[model samples]
Target chain A: MGTWVQTMLVIMLIHLTAGTPVWAVLGQAKASVEKDRAAMGGQVQSKLAPGYSVETITVVGMTIKEYVSLDGTVFAVTWKGTGVPNLRLLFDAYFDEYLDALTELQNKKPRLRRPLMLKTENLVIERSGHARNMWGRAFIPSHLPAMVSPKDIQ
Target chain B: MAYRAVVIACLWFVSACGSSGGGNGSAGPQPPNVLTVTVGGSSVCRIVNQLCTQVTICQPGTSTCQTISDILVDTGSIGVRIFGSVLSIPLQQEVESPGHPIGECVSFIDGSALWGSVQLADVVLAGEPAVTVPIHVIAPTFAGQSPSQNPCNSVVDSDPRTAGFNGILGIGLFTHDCGISCEINDNNNLYFSCVASTCGSIAAPLPTQVQNPVWLLPSDNNGVILTLPNVPAMGAPVLSGSVILGIGTASNNSPPPGISTFTTDQNGFLTTIYNGTTFAQSIIDTGSNGYFFPDSTLPLCPMPDQDFYCPSAAADLSAAIFGVNAGRATVPFQVANTANLLQTGNAVFNNLGGPSSSFDWGLPFFLGRVVFVGIEGQLSTLGTGPLYAF
Candidate 1:
């Protein structure tokens, strides 16, 4: 099969399998954070900070943090560990959008190998680090709490 | 022009290059311990500030050897990974049991991963004795598995053109890529056992995992000393340096007196105090192309180069680095507008930088410095392994 066809089929498969309960926590209700913690089999520790709450999950050499607004809406997610966590679970409905943006960025001319800083109309994702030690954060700018800033997510 | 004059003077007065310089002097010929490293200029590495070196790999114990160029000299990762397309010799595939071959998925901070089969080869660096060790041979279709099945769950580089280098020689602080973590946990998402057309996560024993070839060398196995000359603030079309194997094992690799030493965690992370905030996960990595740290004050470059900083003018900054052993050093660095630097058509810059969650002293930091990397558990003049000295 052609490479493009294969890529499309893979995307389809990812979309089909992305319907599990563990997905869609990024822009979902606060309850989805529990599903993510359960799916990842990690212990969740929530901390309240003025206008929002931060839910941290530590699992198998990786740490995942979920930021929820005062209204209980998940706003941003961050990860750091030996390897990248499953983005399909972290990005949820926005997973495909992330992949699409990445493909576009990778296809650019004068191809440079560096950290990724992906900014779309609604989401902003920044990933950096090397092997064995990696980290990144993603957030929906529109969903951020009034007093919370992007830098606060980290 | 001044930098060019300095280079010419160094060539004439070799001793003036200092003890860290890779000069054989009047002694016979080029030293066996020194491997010439270059950035740009005739190297296949097209990316700016990417350090490239030559590596020799042979089929285990045979005379069949192939010397590959454009192999990245990475201090942020472990083990040697080569693109299968660039490898000409047939290597022995590492097997899990009998018919099950071992496969690995190594992910970089750039969101790209390499998926391939584990193969054993006789790896050679500079004039060091060849070490027989397992290495990762990049093959996207290994074991009939598709890219989506990669344990990294990320896009895999299919060839050297897209990846920008033929392979990477990861001589980091760790001896093994995954180390004890992979040995004890099957869910580490690094090692896999391929049976037939499918691969599953597996807990690979330490011996079966890909190793840092430096650790397996008969001599000069302790660590390495990387030396590169300083570049002007604007940029340079190309730069040359040396990757001297072994630290204090030979006279040429010995550490100079009064050099500060900093011990790092198992994952090679130190702490950085920048802008009143403490970033405890800071690292000094040559693999990173530029200095990366969070600086809300610096504006980012426009699109295409948006990942890089684009200060209106040059911005001089400093950060305090604190090692786990209480070794403290304040480092001053610069950040220039990427738009202006790119206009120079130069491949190297001392002031190139970007934004990151933590401080990353990248290739730019190696300029004008002779950095020592002590491997884990190994002892040298700079103390024990898992330490950085400059």
Candidate 2:
């Protein structure tokens, strides 16, 4: 029985060690899985969302520098773009970072091993302040319209 | 349930953010770097045989119908999909003018069913008018049910405010809400269908139908353009201006220059290029949430055991734009992992972007470049010009 329990369930670790409330701990994890059921229209031991997939759109009226700072790893990025900014439509990066983040939590004690939702929207830009500010690609200059006509198609 | 409400409130906050900064006129007028797409070729779509319009699609006094003026134009989708919440009763017609309510369950890429009443509407574009068009009443509002959706990813987030745009007037080269293909299984599920303008289950083996809204409209059925300006490398901090809705043609449109260019695939798709990668048969879709691809150079998200092959992490890469007859351009950017991706956490995401998927650029990709889409038509009057510029 001891060997069997060790191989299959990790929840036992929480009850035996963390000395935490199983109901609240398991509740959040269940909520995450239930979301897939909600998506499937009904239930069938569903695990619909394997990972996080998100899209981010950052709108701006002024040029602002983006930087990331932390204790150990210093990931500093100075980005300024006149041409369309990279929306990073790739969901892969997010899933990787998020899943890694989740894996760490999942590996921990009982209450910590909960499923999560990767719900992040692009940082918002409320209104265009004014037209005085210019919009164009930073370095390229071919966008000049030649005032051509519909007859030019020939 | 209360927690769901809280989540919904948060979702609204996020949507408000999507529409704000981009609309501010603070940025000066610069011709948005336009990508000209050719719009000339012919595709066929059968009008739904029996579906009702605005009729029965009402919260009672909510008025199931509104003039075409009230409709909003959306690019995120290929064709038109009207919501039931906005229609007026007088405008609502009976299903097939005789039979039952046609119902359908639309599945977004996020994998969720938007079950609701389905009907048709008379669409008037430019000046012409179609008597009855199959318009979807997506919201359960007509069914007397409050909205219930995954708050964080609902369509409302696409447009936070209802200021100018109301219902969608999709004029993409294809259809919106891709009728059935996005479904996981069981073809005959009628999520959004019509028996006679009323509602019915979708026909068996749902078809990934992408109806072109312009074709359904009474006039200017040719094609459309989305023109805006280009932003510099250093992005603006605020929103820009109204997204110009037409090519510079008629009095309502502005024809700047260098816009008359394009090529077409008989399959109703256009040939496009990005970062030196040329995709010959790419559909002009606005409804997609992000740019998607599995280019060899870009990093791939390693979503564990998922079919999408999405990497769990975003890859940062730089590539040049190729295949433009006018001139060539080089640009550098990062590709992030989107949902339903492939792989397990970190292992797969470490590799460069997918070498599998045909490249795709979603709404985010449109933000900076002025893309021209060529729609197929008489090839004579409907000459190849990027019908869209942004």
DockQ of each: 0.35, 0.02
Among these predictions, the greatest TM-score belongs to 1
TM-scores of chain A, one for each prediction: 0.85, 0.17
For candidate 1, give the docking quality class from DockQ. Answer: acceptable
Return the DockQ of model 1: 0.35
Per-residue CA lDDT of candidate 1, range A28-146, in tens?
98777766665665677889998999989887767889999989899999988767777877887887788778877777755655666788767999887656777899999999999
TM-score of chain B of 2: 0.50
lDDT of 2 at A145: 18
Q: Best candidate, lDDT-wise?
A: 1
Worst 10 residues of 1 chain B by lDDT: B1-10
Per-prediction TM-score, chain B alone: 0.92, 0.50
- Report model 2's TM-score to 2 decimal places: 0.41
- What do the candidate models score in CA lDDT, each in turn? 0.80, 0.30
